[model samples]
Target: MKIELLAPTSAALPTLVVAAGERASVRFLEFFASAIRNPHTRRAYARAAGDFLAWCAGAGASSITAVQPLHVASWVELQTQTHSAPTVKQRLAAIRHLFDWLVTGQIVPHNPAASVRGPSHTTNKGKTPVLDATEARQLLDSIDVSTPIGLRDRALIALMVFSFARIGAALAMRGEDVYVQQRRLWVRLREKGGKTHAMPCHHTLEAYLHAYLEGTGIADDPRGPLFRTVARGTGQLSDTPLPQANAYAMVRRRAFVAGIGTKIGNHTFRATGITAYLKNGGTLENAAAMANHASTRTTQLYDRRRDEISLDEVERILV
Candidate 1:
């Protein structure tokens, strides 16, 4: 197979799998190319599978089919020493799923990773840093909306905060995704698993979105990306969509300018908004629905209300 076929993916075929012959190699590539729909997940699984197979080769496995549970377990044990439990667990899950796909294709006699157990992990709270309502407002207000970049940054941040949108879904939006529904602005987000979620824009988000679209003249191109890169040498929006890394840098810079001390990221706005909503009497059930989470349990990870309580108690020591 041409190496270019693997170019579209973030991972390359391991040499052991390549040595296993064309059928195994084809099946290995197909598992990532066909079975996974989400690009991030596909990239992660490919990397995990590639690493495990390479490790097996170093451990004297002749081919991909020769990998066994011991090799899988030993690799996982090594992973635990260097990575966080959640990350290790996710990597293990990636290996297990890939082996299952290989087994189904008859490339392997059995799933070697099926019985391997990952490190134990449990969490009631997520690790994402969250800004309080005051800081969120400060960050938004600090942007100089006289420029197209400022307007776009303010609107993008507000969209994530008010709508509880994941960064992926927020960045995927197009000009047409923001629309009028019942005399109010609404945003339609295409979330994970191809789920379509639409929410009426908060009054604040409505104003920001309106300013961004009209100010940048992006409203004229409804099919174009909503958040875009600034063209070189011109203070204008480019047709190229802003990448996630750029958005992250934008957030960090905006926070520093706004005097916010929290080390925030693209997901910070989502968690900040959820915690703010719950503190203001919004029910967990409603927050889950608004966030388009399949379960309230998943939504709980973003609730940082306990953070305030912990701070309050710490302040009482008065020492």
Candidate 2:
């Protein structure tokens, strides 16, 4: 879906519709859209543009030509009070690109936000919480497998922990994505950033999945949702896929059932899976590849660096 931001043009200036039949504006929009195909990126850009235009209104700048570096700097400062430095920087980048479009289209003299500076922040702080092995076991044991919904939830948790899939990817998955080959179940994941990944299902997951499929009687239709909500009244599973918020709620519910007082969420599984793999002698390179991270640095943050597996220690120094 295309989002439009309309800023009133000055009466003294020619009424130029930025996104209407303008070759440069069209090209710029196409390039920006292509660079960011993810829905999150689109939402971020829409918000940033809204803030910039609102600022423009307050500053008495009706047209793109009236914007100045000071106005851009002021907006950055205002955003920094509520958002992180990286977020502020992202907003600045969006504004810069918008002005560049204006400049290229001859709607503005130059890009005023070109030299606008963004706030700085620490890059090494770990934010995602991870579950230990005990916690993982407790979460699984908390579910009542006697019920069909409980069985389905157990299978979903197993997939998240084993495959390290993002909640969105898990919810977006369809029945056809699961297939049996060579006596092993393979799950096809439609990952973020438009990438496809395959993860091997362990025996435990395979058993749980089999139970869920048979109990729910979910069709083998390739396009149907892999997981669905069984109607409360009729006890029939609906084909609608679960939403991301629903996935988080499921995790929270499981955490409560397991007596885990800590704040566990969908991201916890991702970090826990990566940490468990590495602690079991998996290499950083392989972990990075599995996580689909472009750099090992991103994956390193997920590893528990405090618990070193080294055997070397001087007795005197240790004392």
Per-residue lDDT value at 176 in model 2: 84
**All models: lDDT?**
0.91, 0.75
Model 2 — TM-score against the truth?
Answer: 0.83
lDDT of 2 by residue, 109-195 (tens): 888999888887766526777787778888888898887678878988888878877777887888888888877988888888779
Give the range of the ten consecutive residues with the poorest summed lDDT in model 1. 1-10
TM-score to native of every candidate shown: 0.96, 0.83
Evaluate model 1: give its TM-score.
0.96
Query: Cα deviation in Å at residue 253, candidate 2?
Result: 1.4
Best by TM-score: 1
Q: Candidate 2, overall lDDT?
A: 0.75
Query: Which parts of model 2 have CA positions greater than 4 angstroms off?
Result: 1-35, 104-106, 305-319
Question: Model 1: per-residue lDDT, tens digit, 255-297?
Answer: 9999998899999999999999999999999999999999999
